[model samples]
Structure formats: C-alpha cells, structure tokens
Target: MPDSLLVVDDEPAIRHAIVRAFAELTVIEADTAEAGLAAVRERYPDLVLVDNRLPDGEGIELIARIRAIDPDLPVVLLTGHGSTDLAVDALKHGAVDYIEKPFKIERLRTTVSHLLDKQKLGRQVARLSGKASGRSHLVAQAPAMKRVLGLIRRVAAVPSTTVLIQGESGSGKELVAKAIHERSARAEQPFIAINCAALSEHLLEAELFGYEKGAFTGADSKGKAGLFEAANGGTMFLDEVGEMPLHLQTKLLRVLQERRFRRVGGLTDIEVDVRVVAATNRDLRAEVVAGRFRQDLYFRLRVVPVPVPPLRERPEDILAIADHLLKRLAPELGRPGLAFSDAARQAMVAYAWPGNVRELANAVERAVIGAEGDAIRPDDLVLDEILLEQRPAPAQVSAAVQAPIAASSAPASAPALPPGTLLIPPGERHLARIEAMVIKAALADAGGQKSKAADLLGINRTTLYNKLKDIGLEQAESAAG
Candidate 1:
C-alpha cells in the first residue's frame, strides 16, 4: 500500500503545494485541528504535517493529542519564519520535525522521505526483536532449556495468569516473558517493559500508574499516561520485580486483584486489561522471608512460576546460540559474514559464561568487529581467563551451521578466498558491499535457489529476497557478477 500524508493547515496555498509536490503519496488535507484529529482517527496516515496556527487551536496542542492517541505516530509542524521558537516548542511537545513557511519543495520532500524511512526501519526492528523473543530464538538445545520452553508454551496460553519468571541475571528472562506474551490471546497488543531496579520508588510509581498535570516537579504539563495505560489491552513485563519497593508492591497487588488503578495524584480509577509478566534474578521467596518483600504480593505475582535456566546449566546450547547470535549481529555491526574460528568456538563453549547469554552476545559482537579477516580468532575475542577457563580441544564448525564461516565452500559467484578469506579491499568495508557479497555467496552456494540460500544464511527467504532487492542484486546477473 502507498503511504499517506496528512496535511493540517489553514492556508490553502500551502496545502495545495504539498499535495502537488508529493503526487506519488496519498495526501489528505484538513484546515482545522478538529478536522485533522478526525482524519487521524479515521485514516491513520504514515505522516502528519500540521501548521502551527491551526483554525481551532495550536498545532503543538494537536501534536500532544495525536501522541496520546498513538505515541509512535510521526507529526511535523509548519511554522512561519518568525516562529522558529514555536517550531522548537512543537518539537519538545512531540512533533518529530518542523518546517519554516517558505521551505523549499525539495527540502520538504527530503525531510518527509527521511522520516518515513526512519519509521519503516523502526517497524522492521520491532518485528525482528519480536521474532528474536520467540521460543525458537531462545536457543533451547539443552534439556533444561527445552523443559523451560515446554513450561513457557503450556503457560503462555493462559492469558490473565500473572507470571513470575525467576532466573540469574542475563538468563533470557525477558525473552521468555515476551514469548509468553506473543503466544497469548493478547499477542496483537503492546508489550511494555520496565526494570524495577532501574528507578527510584517514587519515579517507578509514576511510571507504572502515571500522574496528573503538575502532580510532581518536572512532570509534563499535560498529565502523562503511565505504562499501565500504555499497555492497556496488552502485556507488561516488569523486570527485576523483586526490587520493587514494598509500598508500591501493595499497590501492585491491588491492581492484580482489582484490575484497576488510579494515577499517582488523580482521583479517578483507571481500568486496564493487561497481563503482568514479572521477572527477577533474586529469589522472591527468600526476599519475602527476609521481610524485604511482601508475601501477599509475591503470591499474587507467582500464580505461575517460570524458571529460566542459566547458561552454565545449558552447556550444549552455548555454541549453537553463539552461532545464531553471530548471524544476527554481523549485519548490524556492518561486518557481514564474520564468523568465529574453531578455536574461538571451542573457547566460547568451554567458558562458564557467568553473565549468561547477554555476555556471550557481547563477546561475539566484540570479536566480529575486532577480527582482521572473516574468521575470528581467539585473539580477536580478547576473552581473558576471567571469562573463560581452559579452552576445550578445537572442533570443526559446520558450514551448514554457519554459512558465512565456510565461504570457501560457497558458490562460484563468491569472491575468491585465499585459504580462509572473504572480505572487501582495505578501507572499503561498507555495509552495502559486504551485504551484496554475502548475498551473492549464499545464492551461489544454493545454486541460484533463493529459499535454500536463505536457509544457508539463517534468514527467511522473503528477507533474503528483500535484501537482494535492496542491494540491487534482484537479477541473477547482478548477484553472479
């Protein structure tokens, strides 16, 4: 579907000009704030361009209202040359950008294109992260993790049951929480997450339930909606739930029991339909016994307890998970096709991984960026004895397991590798070139088979095709040449 642009301006000339300039886009125009809001509710456009001087009210005010409806929506303000201050204020009020009245058509088009591209990328990233949080992406080759996955699947179908996930830090608790949320009936709704340990008690309360206008110092003038409100009709993941202050825990228990909560300083009770998924590294049972946590709240949260096993207990999954993460991380780090040597893989598998999967990902990312060639050596990893003990004997990393690692076995279109080599010339390591190279190699390896190539590269066939289309490799000749 073509993207739509909403132009909210009282000036006919400005609106007509915008409509004429973007003949490719579907332009919907409104001359007043009320009309613009109605258009927004009726047709959710990809972007909004609102003049600061709307017929009924200020564009900045409309921007706030638009944000209240959908915080992710992009709004741009149109301002007079003398109203630069108002433009800045509009940005502070959640307008993504502003344009002076006498703006160039090309500049406006460029700005709109840039913002649309940004929104597209944001959506793609969100989709990718959602996929990453699935059960399959959790890397459960080991029995312990397999059992954890089983438990998660069983409980995920229960929509309203509050889940308390206990695990060591970096043990993929959030991933499990997200998997449950995704599987539940509320899958289409929001999945808001916050760390209880990251904020002060007062701040956390406001964040959870929100506050009224001027309810506290430094608060937004327009009373903000809290995560609970934001997550209405969805799921909320409370990470480090054991760190919640006792006073807030009491309020949380009330919400669990009543399914309603009042804003921090507001009189009205706000109702929300949201599933609560709480996770913590600490033992809440122990915390309750020690008088640091409320027993009643603990029971409320642990309606179904899910335990995420640490990496040490799931040693068999270390290498496989590392390989999975490497494929995902390589493109993001702008070093496509980077892979760990057999020695480094052995070292990774042998390590205790005290910090769990999070640490492993960081180490892999560091190694990928630091590697001189496509093959990442132990030296490139810079892993000290503190992170890894005695390295296990070297084992061959399978070409099937890591397609980019075994470039020599790749197709004829792939650039010639000297021994174990695959890279662009020095100082020319651009993402596009590396991406094109990897795609060509994968396609070559699969004998021009897109689906098989996608499998080889650890990505979906559609994604592979999209990447090829994006990098001007859609045609066989481009891919081969």
Candidate 2:
C-alpha cells in the first residue's frame, strides 16, 4: 500500500495542491494541529505535511504526540517566508524536512519520496536491531538472521498472526518477540513475558489467566489481572512454550482460538485483543511427535516460527557483538570503553562459540572486569578452555597468529596442514588454497567446463584457466582420468 500522508494546512488551495501533487499517496487532509493530531492518533500516517501555524496551536506541539504515538512516523512542515523560523522550530521538534511556500512542487515531491524511503529504512533498521521503541534489543547478523529480520518486518505489518521463535538456548528469540511487538499496531500497549518453564502448572495458569480474590492462598484480596489480561491490547510473549504443561497448553490454545478468556475464580469471561508471540529453545516438533506437546497447540503457537541461528554460524559477527557489548557494559563496569587488542579480537573471532550471544555477553563482561589497562588481551577473555574443546583432537594453542602450523608446532614428519581434513590456510596466507577450492568447486559444478566455470565465478575464462594452472587441478584431473 502507498504510505499514508496527512496534509495539514489552513488554506484550502494549498491542501488541494498538495493532494494533487502527491496523488500517489493516501492523503488525509487536516486544517489544524488538533485535527492533525486526531487524524494521526486515529490512523498514524507514514508522512505528515503539517502546517507551521494551525487553527488552535503551533504544529510543533504535535511532534511529541506524533512521536509518542509512533516515533518512526516522518513529519514535514509547510512554511511561508514569514514562518521560516517556525519551520525551523518544527524541525527541532522532529519534523524531518520542510517545504517553503512558493516552492517547486517537484522539489517537494522529491523530498517527500526521499524522506519516506529514509523513514522506511530507519524503521527496518530498528526492526532488525530487534529493539523496542527507544529500548535497544539484541543485534543478530547472520545470513539466516537478515532473512528472519525481513520476515519480522513483513510480519509486523500484519500483527494478528501468532509468531513462534525457535532457537538454541541464549539465541535471542525473546528479543525477536519484543521487536515484533514494538513494530506492531499495539506497540504502545504493555508487553508481558511469562516463562512457561519457570512456573508450575497451577502457578503458571494463575499467572497467565489471573486469579480472582481468594482463588488461592496469598492471592490478591480483591483480584488481579493475568498477563493475558494485562496485555489485553498489546502482546503476551510466552517463553519456553515447550515447557508449558499440557493442561495449560489446552487453556492457551482455547484462548488463541477464541479471544475471550476467564480469570481464575472469575466466572465472567474477560475479552482481550492480544498478539501472542511464543518462543522456545527445544525442538517443538519432536515434542509434538513424542506426545509431550499438543500438536494442535503447537500449530497454534507456531503461526510464524522464527528460528534464530546459533552464533557459530556467523563467525564474522563475533567482533561486532564484542564491541557492542564492550561499549554497553562500560558504564556498568565503571570503566570507559577500552579497545580490544589484536590478539583479543582475533581470539574472539577464532573461537567456536557454542552458547551464542549470552555466552558472548558473559565472556565480554568477565574480560572487562579482569582487564586492567585500556586494552583487552587474549588472556583477559575466558575462552581458552572453550577454544581447546572445539579444536581438533590432540589440540594445542599456537601463539603465532601469522606463523604456519609447521613453524609453530608438530614434528617435522607430520603434515603442515592442520589435523582437519580441509586445510584452510590462514585467510591471508591461504589465498591460493581458497582459489583452488573455488576453482575446484566451480569446475566440478560445470563438469570441468572452464568457460562456464569462469562465468559462474564471475571471472574471465583466461583468469579461470590461469587459476586452474596455479592450483595444479588440471594435472590431477588428467591423472585421475
């Protein structure tokens, strides 16, 4: 759908002109700030062409409200020569761009398009960052992840569908739930999280479907609302849905099937409009097949399951995550952001992370606390044991970052190549190895057709032929034949 725009102008002629110029958009006409605010609150627009002067108030006053409603919404101001100062004032209030009166219509249209695209991109960034409005969430950067982010953006526009987030422990599924909630129509409403694994059957049910007065010992004397009720107009993030007891799952499934629900000890059915975003670390399909989890409930909770990839899949992001955590944990640790030494950063990138982001966060925090100077060295990190475990059998730590394995360790008779079947020369020194692998794969895929392989590799046939010669794959192929 074309993004909606609210054209707020006191002059009928100006409003009509804007409406005609931006005919591609769904324009909502408002002559005053009150009208604009009402229109925005009623249906938040993608862009607002707010007049500098409104009938009841200055357009700038609406900025806080507009942002309060949806901070991502882009607001532009319309100004005359006399109101240029007022335009600046509006700009200070969060208006992205201004259109001066007697301005070129083309310029206004171009500005509008550029600003809209920018606003969309910013929204996507915020969405992918998995942050709630004004609150930072987890940052994940895996190819599998960017795909999930795209899904979040697509799914956010349609908030009614349930979303199931699946991942290994500490993979940040909860963060994704919060991102979806923050982007949905019910963003301003409360976000309630209940860990199904953390509570027993009776307690979990009472906590979710709220107990009435005297429903149980130590219950609120008057009454209390459950997370489902508390999150009436917003979201209920059920973490560890795999752990929810079967009885409770039936109740939750009923709630999902029907919007009306009953509180504990309350006969009256309380209705709520809640978006359910359930998450779990366990293999739910296995649970379903094993009869531990209800297949029907599983299907309900997993309307749109977003499985987060383990940290090991995205080795490239380790440094980025470390830097982000270091910056964030600095104030808490009473130390300003010190830099990571080459060794420290390399250790992080080299280690095969098993526990994902939570482990990484703890590792960074521990390193920060142990670190004395402004730099974190390899020793500062708590990764030696983890690294040793992931390395091949008969593993040993090599001090040389640049030296070949033969120079660092191993008997002269042993192969210089690491114990691993595939020898990946250090990325810098092993360019030839990588080239060989690339050429080998391409040639295999093309059945040794050099020209087609080169095209697939995005290089000229001559370059492919030369690379093939350099790798000595031609001699091997001929000998094998």
How many residue pairs clash in all the candidates, one count each?
0, 0
Models 1 onward score TM values of 0.55, 0.59
lDDT of 1 by residue, 169-198 (tens): 998998888777655666557889999999
Residue pairs clashing in model 2 are none
Candidate 2 per-residue lDDT, tens place, 1-481, comes to 3567888889999988988998888889988887776676544476888776777887677775576556767887777754657767777888887777777889989988898767656654664577543333455554566787778877778978999999998877887887787666776677888898998898898989998899888998988888898888888999998999888888898899998788888899888899999998886764663357888898888788787887766654567678877865654456665778887876676666677888888889888889989999878887866453453312333234223222222222333654323334454334345556656776777887888888777778887777667778767777999
Q: Cα lDDT of model 2 overall?
A: 0.74
The segments of candidate 1 whose C-alpha lies over 4 angstroms from its true place after superposition are: 1-136, 390-481
Query: What's the CA RMSD of model 2 in angstroms?
Result: 18.7
Residues forming the 10-long window of minimal summed lDDT in candidate 2:
402-411
lDDT of 1 at 263: 92
Q: CA lDDT, every prediction?
A: 0.79, 0.74
